[model samples]
Target: MQFVQQIPGLLLLVTLLCCDSIRAQDSSNMANMTSMMANATNMTANATSPTNVTNATMVESPMPAQMPMNMTQPQQQQPSIWTTEELVTDLSLPGAPNATLDVRYNDSLQVTLGNKLTPLQASTAPTVCLRNVSVGCEPPFALLMVDPDATSRQNPQFRSWLHWIVVNVNSTEKLHEGDQAVPYNGPAPPKGSGPHRYVFLLYCQRGRRLQGSELAPEKRKNFNLAEFVNKTELGPPLAGNFFFAENP
Candidate 1:
């Protein structure tokens, strides 16, 4: 009888132990679920944060958008202005090379191609200068002033009427400082000659001394520029530029 009573007590004790184990398991599962929910809430908050949104936007933006507002965009370069040498080349003068001829007159007034000048204004000797040359440089050259539209524009019988001639002109020196073979006689176009082209030619002296007496100033008409260059032994012209003038 005592043994049977002891069995019932043992059975009760086993049942209570099982209940305690089940309660412990339920408490552990609840704690794990709470932890998971907290983690999920933190993740949701981070996704909606302003700083995170800004970072994401920056990552998706183009390169130009990231630049400062005041920054300037790259600009294309423009074409350059015409130089003196380039203007001479456009004339298509035979044997005349291109050079920088800066012509000024009447108190530094710039003279360029197609520049209209009254015979009176042109009569005054103009100051001529050379630029874009080396320092302490002196290269001997010859200068000639001629009218391609002499006598008449339609039929130029006396084409290239020599007006002025200067020899031994150095690139560093002015035209007046050199040897003036023929004195400057500004444009004297005939009344009906229309607008005449007074071409100025520059030639290299090639280290030879030239005398003003060698040229016959009296015979200025019908002068062929190429023939004169050959006779004088002056090599092909270094450069040439010209201006326009008409009878007053």
Candidate 2:
């Protein structure tokens, strides 16, 4: 016990050295902790940054392929007025004309599908452009203008009164030169009758010509268009246009 007591000075010196070394080691550990915390803060900031996030998103997912021109793009179609109206049934058309039938009167009044007109306004013959109106008619065309609504739209007693008919026409400039099945007659709706629908049809004759003679007055009344179309060997109508007329 006396020998251990004699070594107390050496033990005190060792304790002081040990404490300084521990302080040094603790300071070093604190500095390392601060450095690690700063590194962690920088990593979090970069992860949240827009540029890094965008870069990460780009790396994770590739771009999609561009759409082809023929896919769904070419499926879009132009609108047609004939297809919108009930006259498609009377005309016995397979489809509305790809090229519209444009009818223009002398007064610059136009008939487009189901527009209204007075008996006097449509008294004179109109200028009808059939087939591809933007270009012109190439094939021989047969035109038939008739009143399915003869007396009134409801009654239709005197049904399908033939107004005009021209067959084997190529040019729009001279419809008179074409074979006239029936001379042009102005619309005559009976007084008190509400309105009458006059339909004009154009059938493509292709290369063949129809030598239709001038129709008798009796043949004008009850003129069966569908039967005439079948008898004449004309297929579905190429184009059609109609307008309403009635007595005031």
Candidate 3:
């Protein structure tokens, strides 16, 4: 009886040992399967997520069509006042007569004359003659004459008149008898008269003589008109400025 009881006990112990071994083997297999599943999930996530490289490149690059053009800055312009070159070019009128005179003081003055006159005329009595003078009288320091053709005729009531006349001019100064003066003469178009040219002339000379002395002694003695110009080097009898307008 005792031997049989011992055999049963031994068989029970062997069975328990076999069950423990099987349980351990099953736990190891489960752990291996779980690790394999985690690896597979990581690979799937990597494939689905957006790549950092391509996205970064897209953000940095600009579309060629959207680019702007490089532009240059604008330049500033100069004012319209007369320049020495322009003044000289305008003063050299074609067919203008050359007078016997020397320009002193400023070359700019010569340029001023050149820019203001029309073509020259050949008459001893300049196309624009000095008024109230006789044969022996000397030319004023600066004289100007204008042809009506060069003036504006915008207003009928406001006629163009002599603009400037510089007196006591140096006789050494010469002008193309028909050139215009600073104080140019305007066309005294008769009422209802057709348009007429006003001549302008410029002269330069030395010393101021009374308008009286500038005239022929015989003429000065005969005409008792008030002196048009004084001995001072002020200017001509009329205002020394020019403008254009139509006869009223």
Candidate 4:
């Protein structure tokens, strides 16, 4: 009929130009999704600002300095002084009938005896002497004579006799017959004179006592083996003195 009524008005003008190009591509994809959600809400408000959180805790970085802790060391030294002069020479004479007496002493005869000589006995033996040398008191004692009945004298010149004399003995106290004054005497040696040599002498004191005269005519002389034999000019009597003997 007139080209079939102009083909239904050119198929209703190509279906209204494909519904206005699908509403202009859905309004250009909803304006590019609202400009990418406004650039992700302005980069999440510049990372929670506060000047980027105080420049991340003021440019952080600092901590270092600590060294010196160690110390302990010191101790050593001891010895000032100690001596009993060999326990006072082993407590003055300890054994051996004082073995061949020579009781050594240096600072000029510093004797030390009395460990226990029965304490200078008298009725039983001690009383040897030569104290103040003699005086009105009759103190010129001299008796040390080891007897065994004076060695069975048949006139061995009446054998040993010296018996009890004693004289001033305090020399720093040591003669002990347990001292009530002095009393213990044992070894009466002259029976055969085989063992007799007792000597106990200890004296030291630079000065003192020597008045003489106790029957003084040079003190009734008698003990002479050539002028009172020498043992280093035996002296010291004014204050400190000691003597004891037992010869056979």
Give per-residue CA lDDT, model 2, range 1-248, as digits (tens): 88888698889989999999999999999999999999999999999999988788454476799887767545666556665655566545566755546787893898877889999999999887653354333667788889987767777777779998888887754443478778889898999888788888777676788777633346677788777877777777766678888897
Candidate 4 per-residue lDDT, tens place, 1-248, comes to 99999999999989999999999999999999999999889878877888877686665567666555664455664321111212112112222221112222222332233221221232243322223332222222221222212343233243323322233333322222111312224445443444332234333212322222231223211322112213323232222112232333
RMSD of each: 9.3, 8.0, 16.8, 22.1
Q: Whose TM-score is higher: candidate 3's or candidate 4's?
A: 3
Look at candidate 2 and tell me the lDDT of residue 189.
90
Best by TM-score: 2
Candidate ranking under lDDT, highest first, comes to 2, 1, 3, 4
In model 3, where do residues sit more than 4 Å from their true spots?
A: 1-59, 63-143, 150-187, 193-241
lDDT score, candidate 1: 0.70
Computed on alpha carbons, the lDDT of every model, listed in order, comes to: 0.70, 0.76, 0.37, 0.34
**lDDT digits (tens) for residues 28-72 of candidate 3:** 999999999999999887766788444544455665675457765
Stretches of candidate 4 off by over 4 Å are 1-12, 48-50, 55-248
lDDT of 3: 0.37
Give the top-scoring candidate (lDDT): 2
Query: Candidate 2: where are CA atoms >4 Å away?
Result: 1-79, 107-109, 130-137, 214-218
Clashing pairs in model 1? none
How high is the lDDT of residue 172 in model 4?
Answer: 29
